[model samples]
Every structure is written in C-alpha cells, then in structure tokens.
Target: MRKFTEEVKPSRAVFVKWPLGHPFGEPFKVRQHNAVIRKAFEALKTIKKPGTIIDLPFRWRRDEDWEDKN
Candidate 1:
C-alpha cells in the first residue's frame, strides 16, 4: 500500500517492499522485526518534514541473514 500511503500523506511513514500483513518480515523472526523497528525509530527521529516516507533498505525474503549486514 505504498501508493495508498503516499495519497494519505501521513506525517511520517516507513515503506517496506514486503508482502501485505508481513510488514515486519516473516512471522517469528525476532531479529528481522527488530531491524525494521530500529529503522522506523530512526526515521521517526531523523525525518524533519511532515509527509516524509522513509523507504527502508531491507529486501523481502533475502537469502542471507536479515540482520547480519544491517
């Protein structure tokens, strides 16, 4: 719903290219979830303008470990 989010123009947002209902990564993956949350918090702190949507740098279902490099 990235396009939808764009239209809504929330004060701040984080966009992840993962499937719907799995925004925080696959179920039960704590590290992946934490990484996504961390980035969101960073956005929350760093975004200076309203309606800013931060496109996170995580790939959906990547082969390597999710939090290893990030």
Candidate 2:
C-alpha cells in the first residue's frame, strides 16, 4: 500500500474498505457506489494542502446486498 501511494504521489488518497473486485460497491448498486465516490471527492476538495490521507466515512455492508453470487 505504501509503495503504491509513493508511486502515485497524489495530493490526497481516499481508501475504501471494500473488497478487491468490488472497489465501488455491490454490483447493481450504482447509485450507492457513486454516492461514495462523490463523498470522497468532497473530502479531497476541502484539502488546502497536499499529503492528506482521508479515510472515507463509509463501509460496505456484508449482508445479502453484497453476497457473492458465484
């Protein structure tokens, strides 16, 4: 994680606690996923300086909504 962060060198980074294949949210829950993205962007926009790490205030539910169909 540190290596990737160093390589990118972004002004800020938002880390979501979702799984690998599901970076956004459950498959079909586009609205929910997009909402999360928008919130992250909002946090980034508020940063006046660089080198900020904003852990998003969101979490993916492990209920039936996010069940692995495979």
lDDT of each: 0.84, 0.64
lDDT of 2 at 49: 72
- How does each model score on TM-score? 0.86, 0.63
Tens digits of per-residue lDDT, candidate 1, 1-70, equal 8999999999889988889999889988888888888888888789999999998778888826456735
Clashing residue pairs for model 2: none
Give the CA lDDT, 0 to 100, for residue 25 in model 2. 73
RMSD (CA, angstroms), candidate 2:
6.2
Clashing pairs in 1: none
lDDT, candidate 1, equals 0.84
Give the poorly placed runs of model 1, Cα more than 4 Å off: 63-65
